[model samples]
Target: MIITKSREEIELMRESALVVSRTLGMLASEIKPGVTTLQLDKLAEEYIREQGAIPGFLGLYDFPNTLCMSPNAQVVHGIPNSTPLQEGDIISIDCGAIKEGFYGDHAYTFPIGEISEETSKLLKVTKESLYVGIEQLRVGNRVGDVGYAIQKYCEDHGYGVVRELVGHGLGKTMHEDPEMPNYGQRGRGKKFVEGMVVAIEPMINQGTKRIKQLKDGWTILTADNKPSAHFEHDVAIIDGKPELLSTFKYIYDALGVTSTEEDKFRSKAYD
Candidate 1:
């Protein structure tokens, strides 16, 4: 069953989402070599609490950390550890926060320091694939449309689209109905409607799509042990189009990067 939000409730969700967006922005400048994922995780917890919101991922499924700190070949759900990131390496930080009784979840893959040309391209393409997927999350479209868009963009770049972990609807509960896969056929699965919100994430691997779980029962890594990238955005349907509830603007600003790629998806009223 789909959970539709009223205009007022959607505004509340936006507030919740911006809290997460701001948290990631604050963490952007602090990410680099010699910093452990555990350290970053700790900072995230404190910051979210300071905002009067609870860490959504903490203890939700017995997960110990506030962020899923997956690095290099790791796909998602990687537990934070003492391992210090090295230059040329990349890590995906998947974060979730609950505020005003709503949950906001999204992710971004960051380069540890200066990355290689190939790895940088992988990150670039994977992120691009994410927007491609979000563009499909409009009214008159189905879940498969979103998946197919992501898969087509990533596979065409010789990347492997992860099949196991898919995106999901968000609201009071962390994981809601309508699983949003990264690969599927058009016209398949549930049709999207206004007021419906979902997290559309694309987990693209540099090698085969196969994955495995760590002994810790949390981290998921690519089977080929090759580098992978994951990017996500929280989207909602409003006025029959996809509106972004979360933005990478803060991250971009903190890193001094410039891009107008996400402009089209952002809400005009909020602008």
Candidate 2:
């Protein structure tokens, strides 16, 4: 069943979501060549604890890390390791936090040093597809609407939309009802209602949509071994519209990048 959060519950969720947003922002400056994903994971664990929130990913599924650090061809669920990131490589950091009986989950893909123009375009299109999906998360819309928007946006650019991994509803648990896929037909699936909150993520591959899992039983990668990008956001329906509970502004601030892309989804107080 789809769980609808009360307004107060949504506010509590926003707080938890910001904790993760801030954690990603702090790591944004530390993501550079020679830095290991394991090191970044340690930093995230400490930071999340300092915020008075527990690391949502750690110990949840017998996972040993605080963050899901997938790099280059790895799609998602990549375990953090001692391997140092190199120039032109991109890493997707998916994080979660538990606070006040609620959970917040979000993710962002970062580039190490400078990347190829082709990879840069891939990142751009993937992120754009994320917002396109978010725009479909409104009252009376269905889960497939969001998926269709994301798939159409990325496929038109010749990118492959991952079929296996899908986004999910977020609340007290990391994963909840309403599986939000990246590819589907419009007007299908469960209908979205007011007070519903979910994590809408798009995992787009640069090659074929097929994927494979490594021996670790955690890491997922593109079957063709090509690069992929993942972006996510926590959103809630309020007043019959989608409101962002998580913001990438903190990450953008640390990287010295300015954007008003989120302005349309936020309230005046959030600006």
Candidate 3:
């Protein structure tokens, strides 16, 4: 069943989401060539605890690290290691936090320094698809509506949408009901209702949609060994519209980048 959140509970979730947003922002400056994923993971754990929130991904599902540090061809769930990131490399950092008894989860793909033109375009399109999917999370829209929006947006750009791993409803527990796929037909899944909150993420591959798993039983990779980009956001339905509980403003601020992409989804000024 889809568990909904009250207005008060939604505010609590917003707090949890901001915890993660701030954590990502703090890591933005640290992500550079020669930095190991494990080092970044350690920093995230300490920072989350300093915020009085537990690392949501740590010890959950026996996962060993605070972040799912997937780089280059790795899609998601890539375990953090001692491998130092190189210039032109892109890493997807999926993070989570638990605060006020609620969970906040999201991911962002970052370029180590400078990346190829092709890889840059992949990241740009995948992130754009995330907002396109978010726009479909409305009062009367179905789950498939969101998926179709994401899938169509990426596919039109000749990108492959991953099928196995998907976005999910977020609340007390990490994962919840109503699996949010990136590919589906409109009006074919559960109907979205008010007070519902979910993590809508798009995992788009630069090659075929097929994927493979690593021997570690955690990492997922593209079948063709091509790069994949993942972007996510925590959203809730309020007043019959989708409201962003998480903001990229912190990350943008840290990077000295500016964009109004999230303005339309926000109800008020993001502070």
Error of 2 at 222 (Å): 0.3
Ranking by lDDT: 3, 2, 1
Better of 1 and 3 by TM-score: 3
TM-score of candidate 3 against the unseen true structure: 0.99
Give one digit per residue, the lDDT tens place, for model 1 in 1-271: 9898998888888878887888899899999999999999999999999998999999988999899999999999999999998888899999999999999999999998899899999999999998999888888899999999999999999999999999999999988888999999999999999999899999999999999998999999999899999998888999999999998998999999988988899864332
RMSD to true structure for each model, in Å: 1.2, 0.9, 0.7
What local lDDT does model 3 show for residue 114?
Answer: 86
Pairs that collide, model 3 = none
lDDT of 2 by residue, 1-271 (tens): 9999999999999999999999999999999999999999999999999999999999988998899999999999999999999999999999999999899999999999999999999999999998899999999999999999999999999999999899999999989999999999999999999999999999999999999999999999999999999999999999989899999988998999989888888873443
Winner on lDDT (2 vs 3): 3
What value of lDDT does candidate 1 attain over all alpha carbons?
0.92
The local lDDT score (0 to 100) that residue 203 gets in candidate 1 is 96
Rate residue 31 of model 2 by lDDT. 97
lDDT-better candidate, 1 vs 2: 2
User: lDDT, candidate 2, residue 163?
Assistant: 95
lDDT of 3 by residue, 1-271 (tens): 9999999999999999999999999999899999999999999999999999999999999999999999999999999999999999999999999999999999999998989999999999999999999999999999999999999999999999999999999999999988999999999899999999999999999999999999999999999999999999999999989999998888999899999999989986666
Kindly report which residue stretches of model 2 are placed more than 4 angstroms away from their true locations once superposed: 268-271
